[model samples]
Target: MLYAVVDIETTGGHASANGITEVAINIHNENQVVESYTTLINPRQFIPAYITALTGIDNDMVAEAPYFEDVALQIYQLLNEKVFVAHNVNFDYSFLKHHLAAAGYDLNCRKLCTVRLSRKLIPGKASYSLGKLCSALNISIQNRHRAGGDADATSILFNMLLETDHEGVIAEMLKKSSKEQVLPPHLDRASILRLPNQPGVYYFKDNKGKIVYVGKAKNLKKRVISHFTGNKPNKQRQDFLRTIYNVDYVVCGTELMALILEANEIKRLWPENNRAMKRYEHKYDLYVFEDQNGYLRLAIDKHKTNNKSLQSFNSLLEGYNFLNQLIEKYQLCAKLCYLQKTATKCTAHDNGQCFGVCSGIETVAVYNKRLNNALAELQRLQPSFALVDDGREAEELSCLVVENGTFYGMGYFKDKTYLADGLAPIKNDLSIYQSNSYILNLILNHAAEFPQKLYKL
Candidate 1:
């Protein structure tokens, strides 16, 4: 089989918004390069200073050269029916595919990343970057960042890989069922292969072992694989994929558990790629405090991390509605609760349920007594329960405990008799996690859908 060992110098990292400045292809027959092609193209855009600095191919160098459209057919003819090979194969393949299609040519072929091949065949290299790997292997790259130099260097590395691949690693990777081409070049296949086919939270880590992204999945293996399936060609997606060198995961007992854990992990780790969850915060909250007059006043206000809240709500309207219900049920004064702003008596006082607290007719002691009773009732109303569900292993059970309207934590337990002992014993065995309104809602919704799993404490 023949391979088109390819490389390109681009105006930027991603394809959709960037332009290819130069390209080189060396046709290889497994043993050696039989043919070679290289060209500088006018990309119709200003090349950035950094790109010029790295490649030494400035705008002036390509001003009189042909545009990609003028040479698209020639490039296509050279690549068609040949295995496309490159240092980081997806980067080159995606750029060429996007440009070729825009030029009215459909370029499609099997892809092989020399980075992946080197990791498999060569092994134990400190770095897989073309310059670094080539230098480490004592292969001299004449022009460094130039397309011809990189492509020729890559072709030589490919030949070395072919020679060393006595175990047929290349053949196995080239199979239709292999995930080799779909994965990021920096990541090992074994990292993906070891992922469990269970509900979990997965983390994407960079080469330096820093977590860049965190995601939740009902099936860890399936969802992790899905990220590498498509060639998105966007800057964020391309950068995200390229940085991933490792994956870590935590197995959960249920999808709801996975969702909760994902939110908590995203908040804790604050991964750069986790945009949506990082911005999530409970908007409003129900609060109670004592005024100078010794009246225990209740109000719904914006959430504050420093102050303790009676209950959290996603919106002001939700908090107001909940407060209104508490006022009616507990006969609390609307004026004292911040629902009535007028100098006159509150609506609840007009209805004779507020006990004239707004007008000083009710004594502070009497009002405070009733307010204390209302607070006690609120505490009584807060649901304390445990969700007992399937565990990671068959012989165990997963338990999530909610104590007085707050999520306590979750864990797997082997003892079935823990249910008979109640939430205390179960909480002892479970691992603690931070709770938020989003997580509580998930658990509440799941409990509503599957009441059989709900164990009220």
Candidate 2:
């Protein structure tokens, strides 16, 4: 393939925050240079003193030089339909693309990077800076930072790199270039590119722009990528993936932010695809009654009372199961537990299990004391408390709790100073909150140096 060896000097590092200073494009064909263009650009701003010292192209030299728009098309035609090669492809390409877009053009060119190729072909080189590589390989560089000179030096360097392993190197580079699909169907790579590699929540929105799934990720990009890639996912996974057409995410200073955001989103969107994070019906306060003889009867009852239960259970079966296990562990009698017959001197006392609590042999006060002791042991979790953890970003923290008639996973703030920031209730779909199951594991899982603290309301 023909090569357009291009080098550009910019006013500053950021693509959006700066303008181009000088640009040079040298087009080369098989073993010969075909065409080349070089010019200082009127950046319309004072060049930094350091930049002037480096490039030696002061404001005076480019004073009358045409702005980027005047020469864009000329260079476009010259390098048109040719391979866009550069040292650091993203930096150069991003600058060019931004400048071109501002000048009323959108050029999406296929780019190849010599830096990556050098890393693979010539392995274990400490620094891959263009000047460093050229010096190491005995290539002469006339002008250090001038665009024309750098482009010329790059032209020579490209020849040397090609000669190093002509066929083998090109083949590998092409394979890698192929892996980068400029734009995939129904998604913008920008969706995942800038996502911070910290714990946070992400939303999968459908074509109608409605959220379909709410998910929390320790690494948002990687988790989203997993859904898009991989060999056929399971049935449920496939359904979740199908509903997702685009992704929107927030960067939390910490996992705590992600957890809270996820809870809020799920509660709000009520997305069709999310099976988790959505709310579920848990058994409310359990029943503890006393028999005619004052024997404590532990009963599994769901009265829909507002008082927090001993423990939340997903189903009545689970509640029953846990209660039965607790009964067995404490050596409590089924008769006193209200599990079997409605006898007075409970059947368990008759069966030699109950310590005659149903009869006068065991004092009412003593038996009830023992039963209360067991109940206290079983109800270890706080009725209502905030679980404080790290926030999604630096200087941030999280507060998770169930209070004032709601279950909130996490709330965010810019810094710890706002730890007591007033929380606006997060209304999330019951399913969205359920998707945060892993967070429970994360918070409870790590308790060594940083233990998750719980503060009661």
Q: Which structure among the candidates has the greatest TM-score?
A: 1
1-457, model 2: which lDDT tens digit per residue? 6878889998776566677899988887746568888988998888898888888988898899999999888867766677777776556666777778777776665565676656655767666788998787787888888888888888887776777775585554455333322222234445766666777788878768988888888888777666654323134543454345578887765665566566667777888877655654444335787677667778777635454345555567777787778666776766666566665776657666677765668788887888888987765543444556676555665565554323545555454334343333322311124322244434544333354465445
| Tens digit per residue, CA lDDT, model 1, 253-322 | 8888899889988888899999999989999998989999989999999999899988999999999999
Candidate 2 CA-lDDT value? 0.66
Model 2: number of backbone collisions: 27
* lDDT for position 253 in model 2: 53
For every model in order, what is the number of clashing pairs? 0, 27
RMSD from true fold, candidate 1: 1.8
What is the number of residue pairs that collide in model 1? 0
**Model 2: how far residue 359 lies from native, Å:** 47
